[model samples]
Each structure stands twice: as structure tokens, then as C-alpha cells.
Target chain A: MKTYLKLAAPMALAAALAPVPAAAAWRLVDQGETRKVARSTLVVTAPEEWNRATERPSSRSEVWTQDGIALSELTFYAKIKDGETLFKRRQGKRNPLPEFDKDMLPTDLVEWYEDTANIVLGGSLFEIVEVTPATLAGYPGVHLRYSYTGGDNVARLGEARVAIIDEKLYLISFEAPRLHYFDRYIAGVRAMMDNARFK
Target chain B: MKRLLASAALIGLFAQPLLAQETGDETPEEKPLPSAHGYEPQDDLEKGLWYEMDEAEKSLKESRFLIEEPALNAYVRSVLCQTVGDERCAATRLYLLRTPQFNASMAPNGVVLVYSGLLLRMRDEAQLAAVLGHEFTHFEKQHSLRIFRQIRTKTDLLSWRSVVPVRLPYPAGMATQLAVLGSVYDFNRDMEREADAGSIEELVRAGYDPRAASAIWSQLGAEMDATAEERGHRSDKNRNGGLFATHPRSTDRMGRLAYLAREAAGDGAGELYRGAEEYRAAIGPWWAQLIEDQIALKDFGGTEYLLATLAGDDPLGWTGDLLYARGELYRARAEDGDFAQAADFYRQAIATGEFPAESWRGLGLSLMRAGQKPEGQAALRSYLELRPEAPDAALLASMAGEAAS
Candidate 1:
């Protein structure tokens, strides 16, 4: 019974706890370069070189990775309005993905995200480890840490920062397989989070 | 919502047993099929299938979804051995998967994949044995090989038609193709019926309750109906024996099996075995995980029905485990007034002497959500006391509003 909500270590400690493929469709974001994402409402300065995936997960989301998305990914979700979901809708899907609600508290939002991940990841084994109050893009929000085994059944770790401002949601999330990838890239993810801002 | 990833991709490597309808032929139990030996392919087609199946078995062995718990595997294998003779069990390799679906599939190469979700639905060893017996019959009767040959013949016919210069008009060609497809399904349905009859015979000979077969089928049918009702869809109970379904309708299968069970019990010999306590003991450690997996499917109606049935079946009264499972269910669903319902269930679970420590944690969360912060924090503190080394201890303490230790 590994219950939920372990308080995460400080970002500095997480930095202590913590790869690459070039593809035809992927573009490189050089170190120290600033990139606009999610229609320029959110921007991040690359702490290191990273590959940006050509196809976004959704219109409001941009994905970056050092390796393939399967092994590691950093996603940005911007200005998602109430009554909308993080992913595009699929017609005639038996169970529709839950929509975002403007009135959701940070805890409610985290629960919703866990439900979404369980549904989207093709029946993966998902668990939430921790959720804590935090500031995201200078707005009060929540930080979440979680783990899940996807289609490949590889144990993976994930972290996300989310905030609601003016009834619109903005989120930044990073995930990687728990072995060498998570520890190796966690510092970079933390630095990128520190560098994230409202454009 | 079991992933069914590897199993699905392997295609013909596995065969699922859906209970069968009475086909108006002689009951297969009246003349049991000869037992299958360790199969040796005697022809090119058989050889090809064996080779393909062997490769599929290799993939299944390395699949990440395989539940490698030795004790659990041994327990299930023991039940399978009890259902079929030990010699027959020797020919099969059982693999328990972590999937949350109600299914068990036997491959042509003697690989049996049992999904964990099926265990949740079963009340006792008899039901488990019933399902395994059905799958074993499929293997013993060489239904996969028969189906393969049938499919091959159909493919050959289509190929010959393609190469022929003479082409039938649109409707005739379409009808021909439909007939080919319909014949394959019909053959499959017949094989299912044979497997059902064979399983019932084995159960009787093994002295297990033959009625367990029909009981589980009925339960599954209700669960399916509950799922459909939850989704705001009309129950398709009146459909014509599910013309395109791989197995017959559950009602048809259940009714026929019940009839057979009564015939088998005409003399009603000494007490038949159910082994309910034995089944509960074997699954006790993993029950919570199974419940979690099922709830994650978000099938609230189905889960609620299942939990209610589980509670109703217990002669010893609702235990801590059942109470806590209900709490977890309501907590996860998080609908209107669910938090309060979840809190009450958690408290009831805690009142039970042998409750899970997570009950306190759930109580804390539910209470806080229900705006009872003081009581919620107290419950959180109690959980921390019980599970001092819990992975999320520090965070829980923080939520409990405790000073840094």
C-alpha cells in the first residue's frame, strides 16, 4: 500500500537527484536560447540543448525532448480554458477525457491530471507520489510528482507545475524513465522550470 | 481496462473462452474428447503454427506485464492442476498478468495468460477452476489448430477467387465474402460450445461445484449491464444471441450451464467443494491492488455492483478489507457528496479491528475535502503514527499541520 502525497524534496535537493537523439522532424533549441511555446503566453530559456518535437501533443501544448518522447519528454500546456481538455477530442470515444474546470482547486486539478494520465497512457499503471503548493510562472500553483509504467511497462518518473490564472490553466511537465534518465536530466528540468515565465 | 498490449498484438497466439450456447447437438460432456499430449506437429501447416506460437510464447515470457510473484503463480497453478490432471497441467505454463481485465487466454503453444481482474470477479477456487478448465479444453480439443485450418482454407478460397478471370457481379461477390466470414464465426461459436461442455464435465469429475460455472457467467453479465447503464447506454440484453460476438450471450450461456449443472447433480452427492476461504487467503495480499486497478478504469457503476456483490456473498459479515475498498472507491470517484460518503466508509473501516493503515489516510483526505480539517488532521496524524516509515510520511505530516520533526 504505497499511498499518495509524499512531500517532494526542495528544488535544490531535486537538482542533486538528477540524454539525446536527433530526428528528421525535430529541431534543436540551443543552450541559453529563449523559446516561446503555447502561443507565446509561456516561454522558457533552454538551460541546455534540447530537441523540440515537430508535432505537438495538442494545439495548446509543445513537446521537447533530449531522447525520443518514449524515453523522455518536457511538455508545455498554455491557456487551456474551462470546458476544454488537455488533449484533442476523439469522436465516439466511449469514455470522454475529463474537462478542466475553472473552479478546481490545486488538489482537485492534481487528481484530475492523474485520472487523465491513467486514461491517456493506454491503461498504464499510474501512481501519484506527491503534491505541494508552489509558484508557477510567478502565480500560486501546485507541484506534482508521480510515476507510471506505460505500454512498455518501464517504470518512469514525472514532475509537473501547474497554475490557473484568469480561469485559464498553464502547466509545464517533464517525465523520463526512472533509471538513468530521471536522475540524469532532473537538474536540467529544474533549471528550465526556474527559467519559465509568462511572456 | 487491462492494457492487453502484448496479448492483442500476438493475434492468434491466444484464445479467449467466452461461455457457449446450447447448439442443439449432443452434449459434448456425454463423450469427452481424448486428452491432448505434449503436441508434436505432424504437418507443414501444424509446424508453421507451432513455430509462430513458440515465438509468441517467448515474447509473452519477457513481457513487462507478467506478474512474477512465485507464491501467487504456484497457487493458481495448483488450482489449474486440481481442475485438470497433473499430467495435463505439466504441458502448460501459466503466466499471471497485471492487467485489470476479466479474461484468461490460452495460446496454442501451452502458454496460459490469466489477467488479475478475473480473480476479483471469482468468489472461490471453484469459479477459478471453472475458467481454467474451459481454457484447458480449448487446448486439449485442438480448437486453435482447427480454427487455423478453417481460416487457412478461407484465405485460400479468397486467393483462388482473386486469381480467377471470371468475376461475379457486385452483390454476388459481396455475398460470397460475407458467407466466408460468417462460416468462420460459426465455426468459432461451435468450438466455444464444445469447450463449455468439456469444462462442466471436468468440474464434475474433479468434485468441484459445476454450478460455479453458471454463477460467474451471470455475475459478469450483470457487471457488463451495470457498466452500460453507467455509460447511459441501453442494455443490449435482447440482441439475437450477439450474431457477431465471439462467444454466445451471457444469458444464453448461463442458462444452459445451469441446466447442465442440475442434470449433473441429479443424485446430489456429498458436499461439493467451493474453497471460498482458500481463495480469499490466496488473494488477500493483492486484493487492494486489484481493487485499485479496477477502479482506475472509471467504471463506477460496475465497481459499485461488484463491491456490493462481494459484501453480500461474505457469510462472516463485512470485513475491514471490504469496508476500506468501498471507501477507496468513493474517494477515487470524487463526485458530488462522494467525499462525505468516502469519509464515512473510511471511519467504518477504521472501526474494524484489522483495518488497513491507508484507511486513516483516506479518512484524512476525505475529511479535509469535506471541510472537517481538525478531524482530518487528527486522522492523518494517526496514519503517520502507524506508518512512520511511509514513503510520503513527511508530506502527510505537513498536511497534518505538524511542526518539522
Candidate 2:
């Protein structure tokens, strides 16, 4: 614990304490060049390693950058037989499933979507019908009235909510039953983001 | 994170199912990837380009062609060669693509490539290097090729499992060729273990902080858990489908790596080993392009992990901005967005200097929407000063100025 604190304090402080040189506020959302991906058709071919009856999550496909992994690839975990187990097959990759490559993002996004979808790795979208000034954690911020549902074709589950401050490019989002968690967790995300900063 | 680097020796243990085949002579799982730093084996060090040799090339050719782009091909190869020890390693190559699950590959050659998903989850350089070092071992010692040759030679035995047909030149002795491949694989497995032990050394030698390796795997486990809940499944093998977890897994992998990292960090203030800044400079163009593109995919765990990793690095300046962006990501989704938290990320970004002019504007907008006038007005004014000629400058000034008056 001391090692972590000793090492982490410095790094985290460096991360937390480095004076951020103010740069031009870059808007990733609403950018004309930023591809607005309306929808992505996810396709997962359940590997033989996963049990079919359990509604096992098979594979997943999404957009990613061509080289850098940050913008590409979504990993899956080993299959754990939770119930009356058939194969007792520990947890792992199947001999049949191919190894995951870093470059899969470009293929999954562009090749799969035929280069048509506007692909950004993170951030949610909302229309600013009316913008109300607000502060949550002692910092200047805003609250946007629910404008539009995120995407028409491939919205994940519920009423999508995103947090934005002009200075940053990353956003935290949640999609659930829309009724309960959205209101509750949106604040939690806000709290987490409040604690977020780069030195 | 530890098992992520499969030791060549462990391959044999895991590969007991394969090595036990009838007529098997050599263990393909035993072979290691060729040397990255040009370390000559005490006796068998005949250097040049052993990984891209005949049998290995055939295996490479047999696999599906995943990357067809000219630029990406070069980029992938460059990372494979320049990542570890002494660099210039051209034997291993990585290959996973367009698939949903996460995975990485260390080819029979010295080249290795990690999936972008793996990259996304890695919280820091240590984790990335740990995974890379594990693969680097495969190339440093000629394991992948050695193993492939071993498996290729014994067609009579391997034919039961391998679907790819072994087609050698008519005059050549197929049996002899297969034996060579199998022998290499057998030895390569040991090479893999050597690499695992070496992952810490290489990381230390390379000067990357090591504990992140374990941290990365822990995060991976978290991602899987969340995903499992979403899909309503017992388990989801690998992030995309099944790629990274090919070896035995345990919570211990992280602990073991952490213990090793402690030993690696050593006593004195370490001299800068590998030039991360130089690396960042070189990849600037790609990084710039990717950051915008990443959030669009909307994978929660991956993006979250990536942002945290970026934040984990002290010298790196974009963590706050990335967080600010994440706030927007969620807010936009309002469906999945934690708006209140998004508001907090904006604040953090501003406090950390992570936010530039845009963050102020974002804060102001969010604030105004939430009915916090004074704070929103101040932030918007800051945004205008930072970006006086912004596309919406007129509107922003009007809104801010009106509030001030």
C-alpha cells in the first residue's frame, strides 16, 4: 500500500498537479468532420466455447481506429460455466476463435459499415433545445433539457444522457431502463467527473 | 496481465491436449518467438530473418487476410519490430480484426500486434509493455515459427485437428518439413516462459513502471463482468468474443506482476529508459485522429479504462480533456449518460487545466441548462476569451454578455 501511495501519489499528483496549459476548446461533437454515426449493426457469432442456452454473449463488433488500440478493439472474457456445467471447461479462448488483433477496429467500423458510418470512439449526443446554466461540484457547468434520443436505429437501451464541458473530449454515459437509473446514476457520473482532472 | 504473456513452457502444459496426439514427436507449443533485441542463442543463434522462413510463411499465408490497407500494414509491422529489447524484431506479427472480442497475436515470425480493444483497456504504459514483452519473447527466441514447423511436419497426427492442408512442393519431403516445424514449436514453448520471466526484466530494462500490467488485467475482468450483465449470459469469452484469455487465468497474475514490478522499479530514481514523449510525438497524428473516433464506438468499459489510463500518466496533459469529453459522451446519450457526473468532469477538466476554451463553454452550457446562471456566465465568458472567433462566438457573447448586464 505504501509503495502504491508513494509511487501513485507522485504520478497521480503529476497527473493531478501538472498545470494544464489552456488550449483551444475543441468540440468533438457537432463537428462537421466528425462522422456522425447514426447506427452500428452489432454482430456476434457465439463461439463454441460459450454455451448457447445461457444466452451467452458471443462476439461484438464496433468502430475503432486503424492502428491505435484506444480507438479500436473491444475485448471479451473467458467463458465461465456458472450453472449445471456441461464441459467444466475452466475459463478461456476456444481453439476455433481467432486471436484478437489491434487493427480490428478499422475493419469492424469501416469495412463492416462500408465506411459510411460516422464513427467516434466515445461521447454521447443530445440536442440543446434549451441550455440552463448550472453548477454541480463547485465548477461552472450546464444542464441541457432532454433534446432527442441518441440514435434512431441503434440506440443501446434507454434515454441516453451525456455530460459535456467544452475543454474535454471524453464523455461518460449510461443507458438503462430509462425510468430509474438514468436520473440516479447520471448524478453519480457527474460526481465522478467532478473528481476527474489532469494535473 | 501475467498469463497474458504466455510462457513457452506453459504452452506445453496447456497444450497437453495437442501434444498428446498420436505420432507427435516435437511440441509446437514449446517454441518461442524469435529474438527482438538480436540476442543470439548460445549455440543456435543463426541470425537474419528466421521467423518469415518457409513453413512459417505458409502458416501466415493460410490465415485469413485481415489487413488489406497499405498504410495500416506498415504501421502494424513497425510496432511489431520496434517495441522491445533492442528493437528491429521482424519475426513476429499480430493478427486479429473486425471481430467483437479482444485478442492479440504473436506470429510464428517475430512480429506481434495487439488488438485495439487491448489498447483501450490498458491503463498505462506498464500494462501495454507487459503484454508486449510477453509477445516480444516469442520473437526474441524463435518460438512461434519453431512451434508452427513442429505442428506442420507431423501431418498424420495433426491432420485430425488442423483444417488447413499442408501443401509442400512435390519434390520436398513433407515429413521432414513437418518435423522441423514441430521441433521449433516444442522449443518455442520454453521460450514463451522465458519471455514471461523476462516481461518484468524487459519492462525494467525499458524503464516502464511495471505494476500497470496487473492493473490492466483487473480492468479487463471488470469489463467482462459488465458485459456479461448486459448480454444476460453466464460469461463472455474475451472482450470482442475470444482473443486475450487463451492461457490459464487467475487473480494472481496481477499480484505476481506487481511483485515483479516492485523489484524492477529498484532503489534509485530511474534514468529515463524508453522515450515515451518521443513515442507520443511520433504517434501524435494517429493519436489526434483516434481520440475523436474512439468515443463514437460507445463501449463503456473500454473508453472509461482508456481515459483513466491517460489520466494515470502525470506528464500527459490530455487526461482532463479526455474526461471532459467523456462527460459529454454520457450527457449526449442522456440515455446512458450520467449528466450530473458529466457536469463534474467538466469541473475537473477546468480545475486541472485539462479543459481549454471549449470546456468552459461546455460548462456554461450545461450550467445554464441546469439553471445555474452566474457560474455558467463566467464559464461562457472564459470560453469566448479563449476562442474569440469561435463559430458560435456571437451567440456565446450575446448570452454571456446579457447575463452580465
Q: Give me the candidate number with maximum lDDT.
A: 1
Model 1: runs farther than 4 Å from truth?
Answer: A1-25, A91-93, A101-110, A128-134, A139-142, A153-155, A163-168, B1-37, B155-187, B234-245, B313-317, B402-405
Cα shift from native, residue A162, model 2 (Å): 21
Q: What is the C-alpha lDDT of each candidate?
A: 0.68, 0.39
lDDT of 1 by residue, B167-197 (tens): 1111111111111111112225677778788
Residues B282-378 of candidate 2: C-alpha lDDT, one tens digit per residue: 3444443344444544444445555665665554655665767766555433332254666777888777864545677767766665567688789
* Ten-residue region with minimum lDDT total, candidate 1 chain B: B166-175
Task: Give the per-residue Cα lDDT of candidate 1 at B196.
Answer: 81
Query: Candidate 2: RMSD over Cα atoms?
Result: 19.4
Error of 1 at B275 (Å): 0.5
Q: DockQ (Cα-based) per candidate?
A: 0.14, 0.03
Clashing residue pairs, backbone N/CA/C < 3 A, model 1: A18-A183
> Candidate 2: lDDT of B228?
52
Error of 1 at A70 (Å): 2.8
> On a 0 to 100 scale, what is the lDDT of residue B9 in model 2?
25
